[model samples]
Target: MKKLTCTLLAATLAGTFTASALAADYTFKFQSSDPAGDKNFQVQQAWADRVEKMSAGRIDIDLLPVGSVVKHTETLNAIKLGILDGHITATSYFSGKDPAFGLIGNTVGAWSDTTQLLQYVNYGGGYQLMTELYAPYGVKFIGGSTTGVESFVSKVPVNGVADLKGLKLRAPEGLVQQVFAAAGASPVNLPGSEVFTGLSKGVIDAADYTVFSTNQKAGMNDVATHPVQPGFHSLPLIDISMSQKKWDKLPEDLQEILTTSVRDFAYDMTTQLKIADQQAVKEAQANPNITIHNWSDEERKKFREIAREQWKVFAQKSPNAEKVYQSVTKFLEDNALL
Candidate 1:
């Protein structure tokens, strides 16, 4: 009987020790603005997986889908209030709070590819500017990535700038909307989840939502027959942010693990998105019902001219907006884009 008692006690003690060792050092509830089944969301999951492996399970991030715990636009506040540990979302969603957010979120018609934008943010002092911008909100800027050029999906053929006149389109709330409005098109602001229904119900004549792969996954091509290729207006920047309080509590090694992991993930996402976009474009062209058209250089030039005017208006919104605008423009000029 004494031998049995000793064995039971030893087993219980061993179990307790194992459980204690397995406990995660940090368990974060991280939400993303990407909807489930989208390529971006899948990539986010892969990012979480990589972080977990790199951290050796010391940090466990719970990845939630768009609107799972909070509205897409409300993630910043949720993170600040501690309702969520962090979020990966488009920076433009907070443009209403500060025009600087939109200017930094996406500099419409400023760059021809994602690499330029990434370089500007990672090495051109953009990270410091963004960190300063979000400091007042109690959020920490971790890192960011882009979805590359989006397709302008429309029911009607938009072969040139003239086709946009009087056309009703759905655009994100920021520089893109203003640029579209200036080009004689009526721009409506809507969440990405509602875009397909808007197109199906005849509510919007056209939409500029996401990368070609994501749009195809969302089945946007079925509803919109004419999609403009090499989309000219916008390339959105998606950011990873955490609560300042949570960030401050992390150890230096953990912080390095997270930041580096996110940066590498950003590069991976950009490459995957670009490759997927090519496949989507090829599949779209082979479909008989879909018609893909590219805008002429003159049309693109006209759009860029209008975009510059909108940039001036955006810069006038606040001092910070002006600062971000100047920084981006200087980067463009240095790169020979301006």
Candidate 2:
């Protein structure tokens, strides 16, 4: 664990800044998909701190939370234009670019654990395929991070696919929403900023958002009294990527510092957040206002089946999607996860 004294400026960094204007040899304005209140955002700041230490103060990452410099979905373009240097965001948000992004981004219901996804990304050709996917856009796929298995936020009990029928919920986007809609729920698209108010004001009945710890920490349980534990849906790949042009100019040692620091950050995030999740679960259990739902294996299997069917359908959307679909299924099959 890193000490809290390592500082990284996390603010609205919307313009390009050069090293000449800062103390470090390089200054990257990186944006995260998580809001400032999210624990994931705190972890991101820590990752920035790790980079600074790993680079011996030669790199400065001005980490901004979601919507700080650009809307969460716009960071890839922002990086290409040098409006921002990089992003820590979900790949599924770019599903519109290619269903490949959606297929690889969440692979909805494919992961019962995060290690399965990480194993694929780091060793199962996912890294190479993702690198190729990003090349055309002038971005370099650095590495991926996760929030562990996510928990569902709900205002009502959802025990099975049958329970999802007509339930209106705000899914993160694209792949997740498509899966839920296929499972018989009415999936609404809403940004993270609006979720709490959406639930409190009766705008939506549920959400497929972040980890149990994050939802609990955000007081989401107070309004959305029922939550699904050991989430059976999405476990997103939080992609860390930089501008290809920026990456090319880095010294080999500096490049190593950035990539290696990100790998360490991924492990750090998964470990710490899982610990926080366990603690939050206990807190939720003690709260009278909340109901934690643990779906039976049979119910979970049913949801997984629905998700698998959607995977094949998505693969047909584009050539790139087919590539992602094929590689991902092979990984799951080889790992005996399918």
Task: Please give, for residues 17-135, the per-residue lDDT of candidate 1 as tens digits.
Answer: 89987778999999999878878899999999898888888889999999999998899989988899999998988888899999889888776688888898899888889999999
Name model 2 segments beyond 4 Å from true.
1-22
Write candidate 2's Cα lDDT for 1-338 as tens digits.
Answer: 13433323222231234343446888889999887877788989999998988887889999998898898888888988889999999888898878899899999999989888888989999899999999988999999877788999999998888999999999866678889999999999897879999999999999987899889988999999999998889888888999999999999999988888888888988999999999999999999999999889888889999999999998999999999988998988888887
Q: lDDT for each of the candidates? A: 0.88, 0.88
Clashes of 2: 0
Point out the worst 10-residue segment of candidate 1 by lDDT.
209-218
The most accurate candidate by TM-score is 1
Q: Give the TM-score of candidate 1.
A: 0.94
TM-score of each: 0.94, 0.90
Question: Residue 197: error of model 2 in Å?
Answer: 2.5
